[model samples]
Target: MRLAIGLAAAAWAVIGSAASAQDYRPTFHPDQLKGPPAGAFNEVLVLGSPHLSDLPDSFRAEQLQPLLTRLEAWRPTAVAVENLSGLQCDFMRRYPSRYAESVEAFCYDPSAAGRALGMDVPTANAEVERLLEAWPKAPTAADRRRLAALFLAAGEPGSASVQWLRLPAAERVAGDSLTAEMAAALDRRMTRKNEVDLVAAVLAARLGHERLWAVDDHTADSATPPDEEEAQAKAIMAAWDNPYVQARKDADQRLYADLEHPDGVLNIYRDYNTPDTQMVVYRSDFGATHVEPSPQAFGRRYLGYWETRNLRMVANMRDVLGRYPGTRMLTIVGASHKGYYEAYLNQMHDVRLVSSDEVLR
Candidate 1:
């Protein structure tokens, strides 16, 4: 009987070893694994993309191809987008007129600004130009009014004559001031516009899945700038006891320290919003709280508001998962979001995390 029991144990050990060996594949490709079951929605792929304007042709050929192959293999039911802000959605459904108003208000008026810049304005795209030429000779009254406001804001008069006017002394001074501010604002807007386009194109090409879900929360405001380094340090120190946050800080420090730039530390600092002044405070605070040495305090804080916002985002993703049941999802978001997203999603019983490196490569 004892001999029979020993043999049984040996058989179990051998089986375990074989299973482990089968699971451990050294290759980097996603094709190394089989797709999830047809009725099972168990996997998710998250990607990080540089702004639309920054994506080069090389990125499409090199990075995007592998990602496409993985998505095709997985055959997700839907592709989610980061666009579709609240304002955009509102315009889509209830407020069609307001939506049209907003679009006209937002776009740059080429005719007025082009003439002021001493350039002959070319028509817009063929479709737009064709519509404009065939139209009631002018834009709709609302569109015309909106364009006039935009033109005035851009330091070009909506009236053709005012566009060419040599401004009177006082008006010229005000115009100069407005022109400087408008140019700066325009530059910033243009930068963001290009980035958005780049991200959209890459996602569209790679996923090709219809029913794109826009999961972003438009209400969340931009991150506040840390007033000083020390303030930022204190915020980082505050999270020291949390193992996950500590691991992230350690990784960021090692990455930044290796850089040659004096401002290298600033990358981690800015990422965390840690001010230098708060560093000593965090150091002292963390030391008092623990007996052992700890990772360097990076001086960034994730406040209560940020935590709530992230929780909502996770809930949104879960809701989408529930609705689609078995469909794979690809989430593209900022790098700072990587930790929170992974932590929340990893806890779910049905979810499998696919690394960006696996997909991108």
Candidate 2:
């Protein structure tokens, strides 16, 4: 009788355990059962570049061709540059003085291009279409300059760069209504701050793309008071005193030495987008710990501004990129922004990253 009773209890316990197991439900919903279909995604290549043009001593214009060639083979459908969008253009046009600091720093010449082309942005763009439609099979240097001037007038520097490239090296010298400053600007496209951006524009025009996407955001950035700003900037730089900073400095020294090599330039970008390098950016630059008597209080504020700027910029990219599925896109941004962009963009359902390695190779 005792044995039978024990067996019955064991059976009851098993039955109760089974019932509980059956009643259990998962927290995950059916809607998240699978990711979007593989075909419904855009392949993004985030190329993180240093402001080489800013470091004039370390830049070489001739070294850019190999890099440009590799990027061109990727055949990106859209190229997003780190420039303020048309909205910012409209806002700045309305109140140029408000953004005088940016204008002065960036050397923005919106009207220069327009003035050179002899038409406004819209009219110049229409002329671009017209010229391209009846593009000459064997155009002369003058013809190319005319197209370039029109591209410049339309606020299309990238396309302008392309037209400049079409001219023979001898013809690229001067004259043809192209000013000295404008010539320098076009040459700078291959050397410095706008190098990748200009390359994108060139490739886009070559591929018959109408315009490059301007996706930079700055409205979220807050300016520090001029009097206190210098001290605060120093404090921020002081917080970044670590081996990593030294390591990067060492790397940059090497880069400067190899400025003449295209592979050398390309390597700088490759290493910059690496996961380890990005983590360092977060820890050393964006995530430095601060105490109450924080020397880096302004630094923290700057971090907030940087994040907000990137988030808004990513939103702008999505607005343009999400519409055209399966299109390969390249975002040429400051190296500091690469990690943040990847983190935010990876979460979107329809977007996927193409390893820069694949594209660069």
Q: Could you report the Cα RMSD, in angstroms, for every candidate shown? A: 17.5, 10.4
- Stretches of candidate 1 off by over 4 Å are 1-38, 52-74, 87-196, 199-208, 218-302
lDDT of 1 by residue, 1-361 (tens): 9999999999999999999998997755433243554577457765543343333322222333333455456555555544433223333334443344443443333444434434332222232235334545333433333332233333222121121121222332223223444343433432243323233333443443212445554333333444545654555455454655555566555644543443332233233322232343334333334333324323222344345555666667777887667757766554445455666777665567776544433
The positional error of residue 132 in candidate 1, measured at the CA in angstroms, is 31
Model 1, C-alpha of 96: deviation from truth (Å): 20
Candidate 1 overall lDDT versus native: 0.43
- What lDDT does the true structure give each of the candidates? 0.43, 0.71
**Deviation from native of the Cα of residue 92 in model 2, angstroms:** 2.8
RMSD of 2: 10.4
What is the per-residue lDDT of model 2 for residues 57-107, given as tens digits with 9 covering 90 to 100?
656655566667788888888888887643465455555546656544543
- Cα error, residue 79 of model 2, in Å, equals 1.8
Candidate 1 TM-score, C-alpha based:
0.38
